[model samples]
Target: MVAFPDPNHAVRIAANELRIAWRTLRGKSTAQLASVGIVVVFGAAFTAAAAYGAYLGGRGLAENPGELSQLVSLVPAGLATITLFMAAYLTVVQLGDIDVRDGYLTTVPARDVVGGLLLSGYVRAAGLFTAPLLVASAAFAVGAGSPLAFPLAALAVLALTATAFLVGFPIGVGIAYLASRSAIVARFKTLIGAAAFLAYFGLIVSGTFDEAIDPILGVAQASPVSWYADLAVLAVVPSASAAKAGVVLAGSVVLGAGGVLASVRLSERRWYTESVEASERETDSVSSGRLDRLVGRRPAWVARKSWLRARRAPIKLVFVAYPAFLLVTPVQASVEAGHVTSSLPPSIALYGAWMTGAAFTLNPLGDEGAVLPVTAISGISGRDFVGGLVVASAVFGVPLTVAVAGGLAVLSPLPPVALACTVVAAAVLPVLAAALAAGVGTTYPKYDATSISRSREVVVPSMWAFGVYTLAFLLTAGIATAVQVPAAAGALANLLGVADAAVHVGALAVGVLLAGILATVSVRIAVRAFDDYTA
Candidate 1:
């Protein structure tokens, strides 16, 4: 007879979990981590600046001796909120231990298996965020001017990190399971995700960062994150009690351990319970609805069809929203500086338009999923099929592009005529982007399973499609911006014996002309690709 060890053997279970987590992380890390490098690099730079500022902050403390101490006290609260939210949100999006649950339940007790998952979450959470945190803290310490700041900063970070993982792991794990087990949650999750994303975007748009106070004494001086600040003070200033730091450190560990056990128990109870099987069901169809009623202001039918298709899936909209994030920093800067700048308006408009087209128009036929072959064999002409896709994008893309760019331009300090020129460029350029994206995307179509979330698969646009569209849009936006700029177009206007206004208008005319040509050619290419495909 084979002997089996007690399932609740914490050490063994934790070790197994850690090993599996490491293997999982390593296996697909190349592609995922490759994309994460941009964020990592940006974080490193941000941390370096913070560290330099910390040195200055330390100096300020000599003048106001109590300031740093007061500031350190509130760090824990801020950390608490951040850890709670990120851990929970990420948990909902990424975590799903159902498969592991199925595998482990045959031998180990369910509680023990959950214990392992809890351990994995703890390890993964720390590993995921620690590098950036440590980098920033280390930099801050270097600038802090005392030899002791380095060690103190490390302690502070460790304490905060421990607290976060302890709290976040349980919440995240529980939420992940809830999302999996509950049909209502799974159904509404997309909208909730979009809302959460918009909230973050709202924060960036609000420009609340500009009204910053001194870091050592941030606005929240009485929060749990401040406990970490105390640890730092004890590290840098010998007069501070080691006993206090020891107490905080000990509390963090105890809390974490307790959280781990509670989380495992909670997960076992919920995950092992009877659950309903969830899946998608067909909804009422509206494809036959008239275009004018379905999509007002559009006398055309193609865009309306595209909208219906996108609304049904809506997964692609997430990718479409990528360009909007690019606006956050520039918009913040502009708000803080108290005026719209010429560059941001035109650029925002161009990205808006390009993304709109790419979102809907790029994968026209491929996005048809399994039904694509059927569409090809039908009586639909290439002009109607491809034209509808591009027009679908143009319908929303043109107005949105014009609104954002035109609004910004009007708000800018530029003369009225320049603003008018920008508005025109915004209207024309996206059509060009739509055309180019249509052609390029058709040329290099991607129709394969890609992970939208850890547990779900959907077909999104290819990397090549994104790259081609981005490069082309940048070049065209540059032309649009160049004409809008008073300086760049002044010499051209002089050379042609025309006013700057005429030159600007003429530049816009050129963009519109190019758009018309690109659209014609792109539609032709898409038509050819469709005609070549047989049912």
Candidate 2:
């Protein structure tokens, strides 16, 4: 009988594997190196800026010793919040990408496998924040004007940053593991990611409304950054700054210890076979084919396929949500700010057009993936395939445009001319979007599964498509504006009213005709590219 490996032996084996994994990651391609280098440069720049700021802060605090107490009181709270946000975002991205491709560490010992994953999480989180923190400490030291204080300040900042990472790591790993294994959790990931985005967006938006929320903000006066700022202030004042720094250092040690313990416990719990089984079961249920019916017969085939693809592919679903959210929120915000006419309430229709266009242009040929060879072999003309896709886009795209425009008209202060222009512009968007997709799809069809996320493979068409779509939207918007200006300026003037009506009608006709021409061109280009490649 074969004896099972001891837990100690398993851990040793895992550690070895982790060392190898680290080395393997170090041996990346030139492209990967460039990408990492860019990140590091950005990181270093941010750190240098923070360091300068800390120096300035320290100087100001030295001058006004009383401000030291206030700054000291705020740093912990601020640090805690920032740590949470960073950890959550990092966790989501790491977890989302982990199992995207097949053949991930199936042969490794279970203990080592888990250990490697946890270590990777740590590395990712640490890498993201390390530079900024080092810079901040360097800044604090320079500002303090004491070479002796520089090393001490650096040590203090490192301790705090490490503690934050420790706290965030296990939580992130546990959440990511849970999300990857369970379907319910996976669906919720999108919601979680969306919430995170909204929170970030809200932070920026809130600043715009800060005057109204001064009282609430006052309650948060003891934020963590403030405490750190105060610590710097105190360092130059009386010996009281030294005492306060001592307290902060001690707290950092305690927090760091607690975080490590928490992470270990979570990792152990996650490693259990029962937990993995339960997660797998949940995921299986989540990946069910409930929406397959939507992809019905000929005309409906493209729409159905697009819908199904969006549903089954989590990344696609997540991408689609961006346009959806933008249309509903920021677009609405723009309208409210008078950047957009109220007659174009950022609606589902607008999102559909935008998403459909993007999906087509970027992923058109790439989405076909391995099936492209089979498609070519089967003798299906590229023109026919392109036609089907265009048809599919229109099925979903047109109605969404109308609905958004109509909704905007009802809710906001839109003139009839403005409403007409909005509708005309909406109608033009998807066709341009589709045309762009076709052009890109024909030129840079990505075959590799790994190429999905980078999306740089479809660069040429993607750029051209974007330019075309931008121009088309601007032209449509201009036409609409011209029509609206006259109508708005002279609501009772018969000549202006007639001209506005004529322009609106003319714009719509022009848009549709242009769409037809572009669609034909896109189909022709796709067909020719398909033939050349296929032959």
Candidate 3:
């Protein structure tokens, strides 16, 4: 029997695998490139802010050793809790699918294969590690008053992050193994996702209303993450806490190693699954035909077919629901919080309306996937096809926009005139969304298996739609502010209430007209692109 490669060889193999993955991603289309640029820009901005905050935090810790000591004590427990949650989520997502995709691992030497995979997982999680390490380094520099402290702090942070991933990965793989064999586990995945969302929402709400919950602070302090958070603070504090930090860090390493061993054992099982297959079957049986009836027997039917496609795709449904949820829940929460005053601005409500509209527009074309060719071959004019999509956008977009605007009016300080203007803007947003989606689809319509797998089709539409809505909100907010500021200063002396209302109404009308024109032009452009490609 031949001896397997050494540890160093395994690491080399894993590094090469990661390089391949990176190269594959780099070869994506122009749309994908733009999407990546947006993500990078956004991430860089957020990371810079976090690094600055960490520096300040470090300074504060140095000044207040006692507080830092308490915080640092909680780091280990916090790291463990985070690891547990992420591991559980990722494992569930992988269940039923990994065996088929990763079965090649069975043919490789067990230790080498396992080592490579574990290393790959860590590399994939580099983003998670980088942000915290930067913060820890900054914090240590400020707290310790020594440059050396920064590197030490970063090392401590990285170790803690790695420990969490180590613990999480094995548990996740085991769970995936068990989940692959059981229908109950599949249902549980959905439940877990929902629970996670609720838990996050609860945390945000509780933090915001911490003053009201002060009586239960003691009970809340009993949580494991709270303990870990304390450890994190202590890591930055000078003196005795450093020993405690070292102990916690050591514990993390042990736990991580154990988890990796367990995951290796579990990886021996063979399991294969694909969410797309199940999703497609379910969609075809229930939703595909439902829209055919609504749109009639005509092969040229665009609006009905597009709506059906959106409804059938589970991912698309979730994407649409996300914006709608954002629009509705916040307004309801603000009302409950008693934040609404009689003089509330329409800009706030209009912002929500525009967002809801844009969500509908962007996903339609990308969702078409392999069907794009059929539309071309079937003699369906791109103009008429896009017109139908506009109609469907109105169908879905107008109602949601109205509901959001009306909810905001009921909850906030907006007057009837302002509320009406908001509703008008909301109605116009769908048209804007359609125009943006059509433009993007025309420019970059080709998609492959990966696009379907990652749901990248939604990215361009979502991003561009968001950009349009944001610009609209800013413009409207500026106008509203300019008008309201002077009115308030004059104590309603030059309010000219009717004239202000008239101006808003006119603005909304103009926006809608412009959006409609844009939609028409976008469709024309997309049609030309489609023709060029097909020709």
Best by lDDT: 1
Best by TM-score: 1
lDDT of 1: 0.67
lDDT tens digits, residues 1-535, model 2? 2122345544554465446546645875455567678987988787777777778876665566553454455554455456655765565455222331123335544333444444454555554665576567667667766555556655655565676666676677677567657766655655766686776555554344455444433554543333443344344656445655767777777876676556545554554434322232233323323322343233244445555565555464344444443444545465457655442342333445566666545556667666667766765566656665765666567677767666665555556655655665567656566665676556555444433321112121233444455455434333333334333434524545555466555654664565556556666787677666652
Question: lDDT of candidate 3?
Answer: 0.54
Candidate 2 similarity to native, TM-score: 0.72
TM-score of each: 0.75, 0.72, 0.67
Candidate 1 matches the true fold with a TM-score of 0.75
What C-alpha lDDT values do all the predictions have? 0.67, 0.54, 0.54
Ranking by TM-score: 1, 2, 3
Instruction: List the candidate 2 regions with Cα displacement exceeding 4 Å.
Output: 1-45, 69-76, 95-123, 177-183, 186-234, 239-244, 274-303, 317-352, 450-498, 531-535
User: Looking at candidate 2, what is the lDDT of residue 523?
Assistant: 63
Error of model 2, residue 467, in angstroms: 5.5
Model 3 segments more than 4 A misplaced = 1-13, 24-68, 74-103, 109-112, 126-159, 174-250, 265-296, 299-301, 311-337, 340-371, 424-432, 435-500, 523-533
lDDT of 1 by residue, 1-535 (tens): 2122244654566687677556655654344567767767876786666566666655554345553454456555555555655666655555426345566788777666655554555556555556555665665565455667667767777667767766776687777667667888667767877897887687667665334323423533454445566677654554566676777788888887677666666666567677645465543336435544643422245565567666666776688887787777667777777888666776676677678668776776667778888777766777667766766777788898899888888888767787888887778777677777777778878787566665566777777777776776666555665677676678888899899888877777776666566667777888888878865
